[model samples]
Target: MSLQALWNQFLADPGRILNDLALFFTLAGAWLLLATRRREQRATARLVPQNEAQAVALDESTARMNRFFYRFGYGCLMLALLVSWYSTRL
Candidate 1:
């Protein structure tokens, strides 16, 4: 199909495009969250604490990163849901 025809098709029903985009982001966010968690866990396991202070700092940083990832992943999911809902209503 020609580029113009593809564009016209999308323009006729833009909801499909939004829904697909939301689905893609939803999956990507979830995968990123899981992968980060696993990687951090492995790194933490291999770490040899040279001092108590350093270990505490590392733990704090890891906690902060974990919280950030959780929030980011959930935010993406919520946004995707909102987009999906809107698309359905369109």
Candidate 2:
């Protein structure tokens, strides 16, 4: 079937939509958190030799980014959970 046809079929089932959205947001948030953590770790590990100062600066930046991503991820998960709960009540 065409993409539009498939989308229409998918939307015809509200339960599927809710479940898919919940799964999507959860997975996306988890992936973002993992990626941010990995980047922060790599930046921290680079603090050696002549680049120690620069590495420290980069590590701090990465840490900030990691914190932002972690917070964002948590917010997304919380919002998604709230939405799912609200949907169930309706």
Best by TM-score: 1
Candidates' TM-scores? 0.70, 0.65
Per-prediction backbone clash count: 0, 0
User: lDDT, candidate 2, residue 7?
Assistant: 84
**How far off is model 1, as Cα RMSD?**
3.6
lDDT scores in order: 0.81, 0.74
Candidate 1: list runs displaced more than 4 Å: 1-7, 47-58
- The stretch of ten residues in a row with the least summed lDDT in candidate 2 is 52-61
lDDT of model number 2:
0.74
Off-target runs (Cα >4 Å) in candidate 2 are: 1-12, 48-60
Task: Please give the distance, in angstroms, between residue 62's alpha carbon in candidate 2 and its true position after superposition.
Answer: 3.6
